[model samples]
Target: MNRFRQFMSGRYGFDQFSQGLVILSLVISLIGTLTRSNILITVSYIPFIYAIYRILSKDINKRMKENYQYTMFINTVKGKFLKGKRNVTGTKTHKYYTCPKCKTTIRVPRGKGKICITCPKCRTEFIKRT
Candidate 1:
């Protein structure tokens, strides 16, 4: 028992949060699978499998976080415009760009071409070369 505790403590010391997420996802997945619900299965299983792979595989966690954040950011931006809702009056249609330096996504009004922009997170300036 002591050896098992020591091994777990060492192997997953700082990974408890991720481990918990993985376990929770797995439980959801199992429930979905048992109930044979397609949507629930996809919602619960896919991310659970991915999280497990990300946690146990050779992929770096930072890279996983970046990839997840980028995907989520893109999804959020896409959802906003695709929902058939217009922005507040006086707000122009905006084009969004992800900062190469700090990964901060910025939105600028459309038709602004060949401009330089600075990222708030990294404070790095780069041309919008679009």
Candidate 2:
């Protein structure tokens, strides 16, 4: 145990990006197995190998940057999905409109008859029936 600890003392270690890579590798491997595709099975080893490389890498700063970028990308995707979900859920009670000048999305209450909508971003005025 002491020898193993010493071996890993300066390693970059496992992180979220590594975990994601491992999961991706596993999924690809499973698909390859189900389809019995040699090419896919060979490709599946790429991510697993990269993950192992990351875990054993001594470049802590570079690994941290890579993990940060991966997390940022994931957060951006999640934010977009959540925003879409909120828009969908609010569709029953609100109307969404885009500003003609700035293309900003404005949400207004539903059932308002022939209302003049103002865009908060670009101060554009438009008339719409909700």
Candidate 3:
């Protein structure tokens, strides 16, 4: 009993933001289920299950051993949660926009207008309004 409490209190190095996201998703799912809304239930369950899976995931080693591809996917998801945003590659000096393709928030120059923006992750190109 005491050990369990201590373990819960001790920092397991799990991302708090992701934990919160999972909780939020579960709550929404519960609400959807109670309300009998199939659409909400289905959509909410995706994040809910994902959040639970991420929270229960022990570490990179276990994740890698279980499945490298899935480990990478979870790591990417964890990165987004920990960083509070997705990865973005662009000039540091310029203002940036989020890449529509990969959802990576990019940085671009302040006054750059009609500039072509490319996402490093998905390699999608689009114009940024700056």
Candidate 4:
């Protein structure tokens, strides 16, 4: 155990993306096993190869950068999804519109009838029905 730990000390360790790859590969392998499909099992080897390559890689800096970029991309997608969900669910009590001049998203309380809205960034005023 000590020897194994010492050997891996300088190698790139696991990250979220690596874990995800491992899990996805496992799921695919399981599906292939349960269904007795050779092609799916072959396809599942792709992520495992990448994950193993990352684990054995000695270039720690590059691996960390790759993980960081992946995490940031996932976070950006999650943020967009959450924002859209909120917009859809808040229609009962709130209204969302884009400023025509600057295309900025603006949220206003609902049931105020026709209201005048002024853009704080572009200073463009427009009338909107909420």
Q: By lDDT, who's the top model here? A: 2
Sorted on TM-score, best first, the list reads 4, 2, 1, 3
RMSD to the hidden true structure, all candidates: 10.0, 1.9, 9.7, 1.9
Estimate the lDDT of model 3.
Answer: 0.65
TM-scores for all candidates: the values are: 0.32, 0.85, 0.30, 0.86
lDDT of prediction 1: 0.66
Model 2 pairs in collision: none
Model 4, residue 125: C-alpha shift (Å):
1.9
Would you list the rank order by lDDT, best first? 2, 4, 1, 3
Instruction: Summarize candidate 4's per-residue lDDT along 1-130 as a digit string, tens digits.
Output: 9998998999998888898789989999999999999999999999999998999899999999999998999899999999999999999999998999899888999999999998888989999999
What is each predicted model's overall lDDT from 0 to 1? Answer: 0.66, 0.96, 0.65, 0.93
Off by over 4 Å in 3: 1-93
Candidate 1: pairs in clash: none
Q: Which ten residues in a row have the lowest lDDT in candidate 4?
A: 13-22
Where model 1 places Cα greater than 4 Å from the true spot, the runs are: 1-92
Q: lDDT per residue, candidate 3, 1-130, as tens digits?
A: 9986666562333454455567777887888889998888788777667655655565646534445565577789888786554223333446656777677777666666688878888999997677
